[model samples]
Target: MDTSASSSQVAAAAVAVAMALLVPILSAAAGGDGWEDAHATFYGDETGGETMQGACGYGDLFQQGYGLETTALSVALFNEGWSCGGCYELLCHDSTYCAPGGATVRVTATNLCPANYSKPNENWCNPPLRHFDLSKPMFLRLVTDFRAGIIPVTYRRVPCAKRGGIRFEMKGNQWWVGVLVFNVAGAGDVKAMAVKGSQDGQWADMSRNWGQIWNGDKRHVGQGLSFRVVASDGRALVLDDVVPPAWAFGQSFEASGQF
Candidate 1:
């Protein structure tokens, strides 16, 4: 009755299913552990090839929604006249995620709350809650009122770019800030990312992260960049340990010669 061949086929199918489940777990074990470095440029959309360069470690000032043409995010050691070679590479960016909604806005976060709720968890749709619902096409800057927890009052000057969202303004130079996203449920690949800057971005920091949405830490205490995740399940997304690392970079000239 060809029983042996049929049994072999069933075994093979079982093996395939096992392999599929094992792949994600194995990849997470190998890649999403500890602190890793990521590049400043990544695709902010689902096109898979559309790349967007990150702003300097300080912040990005966009004229509109579209992306910069060829301006790669500049990077160097935290020193005057520093170049890319032999630099410490402060932050490593994870290009794995751009926007939760797969939009053209690059990096985006969720609101993490129901419409009836008075306040949102965080602007990025990340809260300490176990479950959340996500609005599609999340943007990177859609942060929550986390200033009370992680940010100090001295650095609490929100940027105009923030508009109605959460954004920070760090006045000093040569400091680096970072943003990261993690898989809280440990279902998908988690990642941590950092962005470095020195002397107001004469030198630059990159981004970094883990495999899943877990806890994160940064050297800079001032306000940091933002990232987001979809809302679901009982697991929560936490952003913490945002610290500014000391750094220095070359000087710059103003058009008005104010200096």
Candidate 2:
């Protein structure tokens, strides 16, 4: 398996969760819920295809399906210091699937992967979906090599209406992700932000703390980051389990970790 790609996928997954957190703040400012940004679909159950179950929002619907589809893929609280390397199967289009000895092959779909692409609708099941077991808890960042033509299908986010008091896992940390995104094309700035507090398993209250990562500059136009929870209450936060958020966006190049 391509460790770099797998790692990138893991990292990008975190940012996707983080990106979902930005949708509400952006939508509230825009005075409307922004679900028309692109033609995308979310899936819950996995048989190696991105199927739509006709649900609204992003990750929330997907998580619901996952719980019913596969126990390993279900949403739960990851304990601190849980470690194990496991393998799972998934289907993809155009991407090569190979595993080295002792390597865990995790076939997944990122916001940038084509296998997870789907038409925009209120369905919970759609195309371009993936299924697998999360081996560890860590915030992941993904950066695609667009130069190689591995472009993301489109930008996506979780609907704010669904993210109230819900938590998800990313970058090895558990967090209540907000569904939102930033528009750099018109605004010319997409700054990275973080949710504060140990309010695990709870929705983020916007009237709280936010840490800025970037300030919409030329460097971050086509790039993004996801900050995972590393330290909470002055101790390193251990991720034994995590729940996926209600929604999130996909990306090409991604990274994971806490700031």
Q: Give the TM-score of candidate 1.
A: 0.20
The total of clashing pairs for model 1 equals: 45
Error of 1 at 192 (Å): 27
How accurate locally is residue 240 in candidate 2, as Cα lDDT from 0 to 100?
Answer: 24
The 10-residue segment of model 2 with minimum total lDDT is 77-86
Please identify model 2 stretches exceeding 4 Å from their true place. Answer: 1-61, 64-110, 113-160, 173-191, 195-259
lDDT of 1 by residue, 115-193 (tens): 2234554432222222211112122222222121221000000111112221222233334322322111222112222
Candidates' C-alpha lDDT: 0.25, 0.24
Each candidate: RMSD: 18.9, 22.8
